[model samples]
Target: MVKQFVRQKARNITPTQFIVFTYLTAVMVAALLLLLPASVKEGKSISFLDALFTATSAVSVTGLTVVNTSETFSGFGALMIMGMIQFGGIGIMALGTFLWLIFGQNISLSYRRLIMVDQNRSSLSGLVYLIRSLLLLALLFEGVGAVLIGSYLLAAGYYDSVPMAFYHGLFHAISSYTNAGFDLFGDSLQSFSNDYVLQGLTMVLLVLGAIGFPVLIELREKLVKKTPNFKFSLFTKVTVTTFVTLIILGTVGIWIVESSVYYREMPWHQQLAYSLFNSISTRSGGLATMDVSEFTSPTQFMLSVLMFIGASPSSVGGGIRTTTFAVIVLTLVNYALGRSEVRVFRRTLKQEDITKSFVVFSAAVMIVILSIMLLDALERQHFSLIKIVFEVCSAFGTSGLSTGITSELSAPGKVLIILLMFMGRVGILTLLFMFRSKVTKDRYHYPKEELIIG
Candidate 1:
């Protein structure tokens, strides 16, 4: 039976392998569904490369579409994309666990291990509860978002009928809260650029999604249970602090860099709205209110930096992660100060954590640089270097914000971006681990040697 074979295969592979396999499977399935005749508009067939690219983007929850989602895909196709977003956003294992619980099936030890790795938990304890809580919270947040957005759209006559408005609202609600960034609006919310209610709601949903599920869980517990004298975990503190700091800095940075060029004719409120939305969107939200190309080169470069840093770990978004960036900075600061240890919040970090942070950061930079180089060679004549770099970073960070070069990319360029999106979703470290050789104990120690380094 298929179930027996799957169980056997699952037993033979590590959790990391299983996770990668799950995403690949999801991508393939989504691609096939997207290629279906019903999935596309009448009489139009999707190209294999574009279909695969869109599927990968949706399954990875990265919104870098090679085709215009609203015009190219039918309602059924759009729903299929939404399904992939949900699967990728919350993860396939989490959804599987929820179904297993609903069916009254026992979650085996191996299944628990999969869940642990999927959610980035260190232990197996309370994983079922965690899944239930995660799903419930996701539904609640997304449901409220849908209602609010739908009501506003209908009241404002954005759509002709209630059903159409509701569908768009629901689609955007899921997309925003999952940080999937796919949009039904042709220009990706440009019409609503000055609409404070929609933008504010979207920003909040994006933050909640990108802040990591564990942090949300902790916040829920603290706020709902009213825990007395409660303190947040170090992870929560570091992630929140870094996330907020980046938003503030990015907003100000973009405003200062582009005020003279991009926003010179706009009012102060419109300027603020654009800056804030773009800042948050660059951090893996990807739903832009305006064309990214309108900004100056310096502003585009800064947005690229924001996208490269991305969102928090164990969340829907990608990039090197907030904590990793924070650790790298802290490590440098301490080293410059000649300190014995890198400490944050009066707590000393483990040597392994520091090493891992550096590895992740360095590896990410290498991947982005290499990707940019490849893209430049492929599309240099067609696009500017800054646009190429921005696209590469968007793919790597899974940020999905583009300067209008996505559709113009050649076949090879699309494939490269597809690979970057996959790597981003699976994570640099996870991908490295997937190819890492098995460790073996040595019977004897090698002679120690010292090498000079900067």
Candidate 2:
């Protein structure tokens, strides 16, 4: 039976399924490894459920910790979590490809097809070259970020040991770049709110990570090939424009609402930095230099919206995705203008693309609703419903921001969050597609019927 199962799987498995399975398998393994006595600093073993929860959060790169990451886990455990984040960011398949590259193994045609689809590459022909470029780009950016952040932290006298400071820099740099929202600082970067240097470096990391892998690869190709005539694809243009617009709008909105309270305490330059960081982080990065819970009601509402929009397609961060958001907006504009085509940059958007956007959007909203209801049922608290919804959305979007209520959640509440993290990371559309099969219809004519709407 086992041999039969393996043979059947071999015949049917796709690379995307393999990638997803690899991540889920890693999550389970990491959970068990983390529960070991050596993983905890005080040598206390973690419960199965707690281990599973932590592993899911880290592997999903959601950053919602059931236990205090900084205090509960030993250095070895922290490194394990960091490894999970890196794997989650580039994807398990991509990591496997990286290993193959290091070993100088030629990428087979099948592997190339998988990489192209999984990474959302435009063309499958140069898949191996693209994968190599992506790995090099990631390393270079991460290396620079680690150095600058490490130097700043050392200058600030934040750590006594050189290795500690370096590790802290390396941890947060990778964490931020991956949009994992995990921090060596237990308070999650709040200690550096007033520190301008750290804040700026972090912002850069967030932006780079939020942009999808495809965009990064394209940008790198332009730089290396020196193709001055290289044009941005419509998808890239829309994603960049939408992301920038959202950041700007979120920054301005947060500034206006929270400036008198949160920003008033800091100098003008620092206030701008704080506002910008929160705006970028809100869209699924979840790193907050300031205490986001202390923000005014309006500011929290704004953050909820940003978190819902989240990051771009095939990026480290999650949400319905920036491209989905752009499609929805474009569709709306086309409708208002009475145009048949949802065109942008002189390119007509595909009907399938718009339909998929609606499906993704609907699935996301439904998940948020269902999660909020479940949390309310589990917690049995009198907390504001809006805040709970925000938390649910954050988890499902893999944003990891909270109103400082994650630790207070009951066991069932934590479980709910774990499920949400998995759903968000795997993505609602991907999940749907996994269970759905393509259907074929005959050419025979059927009786035409029309239904009235609205």
lDDT of each: 0.92, 0.83
Question: Where does candidate 2 have its weakest 10-residue lDDT segment?
Answer: 113-122
Query: Mind giving the per-residue lDDT tens digits that candidate 2 earns over 302-418?
Result: 888788888998688888889999999999999999999999989999898899999999888888887888888876565677678778878887888888878778778888988
In candidate 2, which residue ranges exceed 4 Å CA deviation? 14-16, 43-45, 120-125, 260-267, 439-448
Candidate 1 clash pair list: none
Candidate that would win on TM-score: 1
TM-score of 1: 0.96
Q: What does the lDDT read for residue 315 in candidate 1?
A: 89
| Reference-based TM-score of each model | 0.96, 0.94
